[model samples]
Target: MIIVDPSSGTSPDRIESFSLESDHSIIVTSLEHHVWQELEQEIVCSLKRLQCPRLLDSTVLLLHKLITNIVRTMHRHAFQQAIEDDLNIDIVSKDNVFDELLQNELNTHGDRNIEQFCRKNHFQVTLTFPEKTDTLIRIEYPESCDSSAYLDSKLAKAIGFTLLKQTDTITPAYYCATVVRDIAQHHPHLEQAGHSELLLPDDESDKVLAVFCKLNYGIIVFSSAGDILSISPAILNNLKLEISPTSAHTLTGIIPGHFYNDVLWGLALQSQGGLFENYRIRIRLPHDDSLSILFNISGYRHHDMTIHTLWQIVSLDHKATHTLAEGSILNEARVHNITRNYVPQLVEQKAREIVRLGGNALLNEECRLAVLFCDIAGFTSYVENNEKEESVIHTLNMILGRITKAVRQHAGIIDKFMGDCVMALFREPHKAILAALEIHKHSYDFNNLRMRAGKDLLLLRIGIHWGKVVIGNIGSSDRLDWTTIGDVVNTAARLEKNCCPGAILISETLYEITAHMDHPEIRFSKPFYLKLKGKRNKQAVRYVQTTSQTLLHDIFTTHHAKG
Candidate 1:
């Protein structure tokens, strides 16, 4: 089991030394110059110590396999150099300002005016790649002068799969002329080539290095059986794409081949929760297809032997089923079956039920409840000024998720989202008040982060009221909406309008529930009179501040206790 460790180093010097110290029979493959000789000796010493029998546990193979796959995918030239020099495998990109590099090059070396810039900077451009391979190509102008800007631009451009090359030849004063001249003489073929065949060596030794180098951005897929299905190096180093070992049992269709059934069984066991937590299995693939058999192996990050073993499990073509009888990989079809069989059909059934309850559920006599309302201040103006519709929506969704979770944590049911506003109701004043306070606290937390980023602040205005309200389904016969009505909701809206940003304001009725609870944590202000709309007498109201330490603790403690 020869394990490849890409993290070890890819330069030619490191790789050559690694082979020298390996079992003598393993043989010294090829040697090229990707890195200097100083670090090459260190790798040789480390390899000698590691070559002993059983020096590295079997688990290390997983990372080795992953690295091997990556090296196999590298540019042929990079592979050759590593093989020649015994290089260290460093996958991290050295250039941080790739975006700036690309942009600067674009403006300066663009086809429209490249001649002038090249002439003044003593630069020459070459485009020698065959038409079949050179789909998109550009030569950067050396006169861009700004190192950071140029580096950033180049990095950004190279982020996606791209054939990239850089040389000091662009400048008149070559930094290392002697070294460049040697490479040009010895490897004259690569000097004038673009998308050179060097990335894909035909020989076995060269091919191994080439493949590993290409593994830079690809996803290495392994089956449950610990067999490799595909190594997609193109996507390996990308920042935008996220690749991880996600469970494939939930995936649709027959699971692909080249995986392990044992690992799948292990994952299946884990999913079973407390009942099967300690379960173990010694069965092989296919023959022992009982759902009772499962495993509990550790997962690995690199392409090692363990991961290859896992690949075998997922590779089962006709293994098990969703049924408890046939311990299958609980594939997508099974998940859909369960969802369709038990879950509610909210889109079609909500209206009919709303009508059956009443004209307006919240307005019903038995529906006395507390209502909470919150609105994002300055939302309308912000939307009008910002042209980035997607960014705005993404941020809004994040805020809503946080607020919604807080409300649900306190047993509050969301009614509707009005623009950036949220309407919720609770069965008891305690839950309602707690939910409102949590919303304020979470909103403050979210806005604080936004403030640091120089983004617009999301200030939440909250209002709560508790009173007799009618709760029923309201709307036309064909489209009944479950909602609440009555003076309680109206009063809550009034309270919201009265409060400032970042404040959770509640009416007098809601506060009455906790006034005598004798919780030292609950902080409040004395009752104040407000001339509310549609009321003759000045209504007595007290605003409760959501920031009280006691109130915060009460919400967390209640939820934690239940969990």
Candidate 2:
């Protein structure tokens, strides 16, 4: 097995160069550009255009793969140029924004607009190839203009599989070094990408602090006076520190050691927290003189309240020049299964996680509630006759937008949207009824607006019921939905199906709760014992129809008052 060692720029700057006794002639070259501006532009433009939250990962991966392929092509071009210096070797770079990689996704997936598809649902993405090759390529994409947070290994792997033109998998160290390089150069923009906290010392002891550091990675410790207390062979070799560790080696004895004390002691004395205690420094190479290695210094306190610093080292060159050879790789179905599972998992772990609140959802609570279900009248026919997908979506969104505003105005929360239907919940029965009334009142105007625009007028039906409900987030641990679920929820759906167009139907439980309200314009249809679908017994319910609004109040005023 090839082991990782921090290097001083002999190999490419992506992977830790490995040497085996049998094959020692491996040559490496670093491609000197963070090219592919076309892909970056597409990423920035299409970010807002995407609809589903899960597809965000795929979008990033697609762009990353594009850059990776270009880089691989550049690496091969560099090799050919350096060794062969051929009479004529043309790469013929294309300017098309959606080039070969994107075209392959279109052909292999479908003819739909990739951006629009991403807008509708979570699309599966697998940059990892089923076929294998020996060469591995590493790529790094900027997370943002000002953040140290970069995408993790899974993303790097996806880019590797898709763009390592002739590789089985991306070697980890190759890509991780890209992260290290980024952190070093952009020290001001720290990588706070997710909730992963930095290593902390539990006990207030410098020795105990070093205990945890050694468990994680190699570390070198030094006193506040800049004297070396302990050293790890890995870090010492990586930095090529000339000073012999005699427990009295002042940090200033070394070259860039002047900043070493400031970085280590200054932060440690200022704050007891992890945020300010971290620092990055680069050391010039003894051999090349022009090249350097980056080291990360972190500070901690001992039981005696003494400040101690830790040193972690990484190589500057991370790129790799893999020798192409045949190897084993996964199949297409395996890749599909892998991709299908991964995108959703990422959404659950990274996207849904509330970063500020430490992954805890804010809407977890129980309350008495009024559930409302509303659906479009003859929606199936509207969809079936709709020839243009964009038109159908536009019309549907227009209606939902109006309905959502009405509910929100009346202190109701839209639980979820189901195709041409929505389920909302309210804590007050009057507010729920008023929300339904708001929909009826505004729809007439909505239909009129559509008619003037030469569009067919659509109708809506609403059903409401009130009962005790756990009005918070509930679902699988990873995927949570902020909605309510109880027997009363089902009854509201049943009432909506029984409701007529422009009518607000409510269960008897809801009627009894709101019967005390002194609303002059509100009138209920004759209360009758009706056997709703799937119910064995008859139940008391009422249908609320539009009478008149003598109050002449706006939708906002009606919400705060009786309807």
Candidate 3:
């Protein structure tokens, strides 16, 4: 235990001695009110000299309550004896004699009796100032008290105290009071609940599960009658909702019109003892853009037979696949038991692994990688000329989705989506070229669908380049994106911009690797020198045309004639 001595001046030894003596200890003997009053006064004086003005009052009250609880737990038999001794006197027969005798005995020998009890029961209170960044107040129970027994007792009922349980091995038993800063940092809601009184959670398992869901997914818990019990902050922020005390929000109020019915159906299925997992739905956003969301529902039966439900919402935007792990589903019969028993162990293991492996060591690296860029040709003009923004966006997403699918199918990483373009990275040059060819073929299929729907045909332009690029996390500490950057990336973007619609372009470096491969369905244009933007010298490139190129051109010609 250590504390800075404000009074000791010019002598390090004196300061160290004062700090050592500053630790305060009190022995609990009986539940007599006067004993605690004197002890509280001593503690208050010591706190006053400690110079923590902001926390002085709260700490004093907290310590008093904690000590009182300790006394009540350890001195229950002594209290019962005192009360029984008082009850022995018959008040109706000799009230005056009883009062005088009891007062004399208590006044003369109460302190001696308390001292004897203190020696019998090994309960003592000690205040030690540990060297820590944050202020802390902790209570250590006697070795005889097991962790469960201590936690079940009144001493552990205080809110904002973390229980460090004892084990058969090394970990000792203690529960420490949460300092003000710790509370604000870890449990901000408790501060808003007010400091006058603190409330403990009814069930610790529920608290653990709530935290896990809040961190990993956007979750909403509903009551039996569909009232909103709790909702994650991410959901509120994503949906732009304002929940207040006076107003109420319903499912219909928060969810988009297109996806609301699906959500309702999911809830109904769960209520009927059915499992709903990965129920995919599309939600249209402003500007006619849409988001792919997957809903998973879990249900719980309360002691009163009321059925409650929890909805785990995961956004599938930019994800390569739309699916959830089978083991991730919460088991209806063992959800509580599993979460209570295993979640903590899982969290600890993950933390240790992260520490063992330097957190960012694997994510950031320099390697030889392939960069591919795909853009919709004339998308800006299409959006401006098309009055129905919905159709324009729908067409845009269709093309982008096709490109994303092709990239993922070829084992490429989708770095990011920029407006109408997607940037992806791959390890092998052949895979990048293959993915580009696949995307080019899919464009023709998309055009056929548009032709049937009486909508204008859209074209796609793709570019591929292979070179040494630094692929790692970029952005501020708070928000980061795993992306690639180098001359290779810029060159790919330029190639995409220069390529004609319905064609795939490759840089000389990338073409060298695939030029020898036998892709009978693909036709490579003669290698030519083209001046690319942001380059001092002209770049050697070739346009790779698939077998569907002629069909795409025929469709374009027919569409122009129809228009």
Best by lDDT: 3
Candidate 3 or 2, higher lDDT? 3
**Which candidate number would show the highest TM-score if scored against the true structure?**
3
Ten consecutive residues with minimal summed lDDT in candidate 2?
320-329
Candidate 3's C-alpha runs over 4 A off are 1-363, 554-563
Select the stronger candidate by TM-score from 1 and 3: 3
Candidate 2 lDDT, 1-563, residue by residue in tens = 11112343332222212322233221211111111222233333333332223334454454444433433443333333332333454433342532564456434532223322322322111211111122222333211111222344454343332222222324421221111122323332333435455545654477666765664445555565655567665555554555466422533354475454454455555655522433556655555566665555565766554545565554336221111111112233466577854342223432343342223343333335789999987788768876474388888888888998999899887777899898887756789998988887777677656556655556688989887554344577788665566677888898899876656789887877677778877888788876777787876789885566323223323332331
Error of 2 at 283 (Å): 20
Please provide TM-scores, in order, for all candidate models, with all chains considered together. Answer: 0.35, 0.37, 0.39
The 0-to-1 C-alpha lDDT of every candidate, in the order given, reads 0.45, 0.52, 0.56
Candidate ranking (lDDT, best to worst): 3, 2, 1
Score candidate 1 by lDDT.
Answer: 0.45
Query: Could you give candidate 3's per-residue lDDT for residues 530-551 as a string of tens digits?
Result: 8998999999999887776766
- When sorted by TM-score, best at the front, the candidate numbers are 3, 2, 1
Query: Which runs in model 1 stand beyond 4 Å of their true positions?
Result: 1-365, 546-563
Using alpha carbons, what is the TM-score of model 2? Answer: 0.37
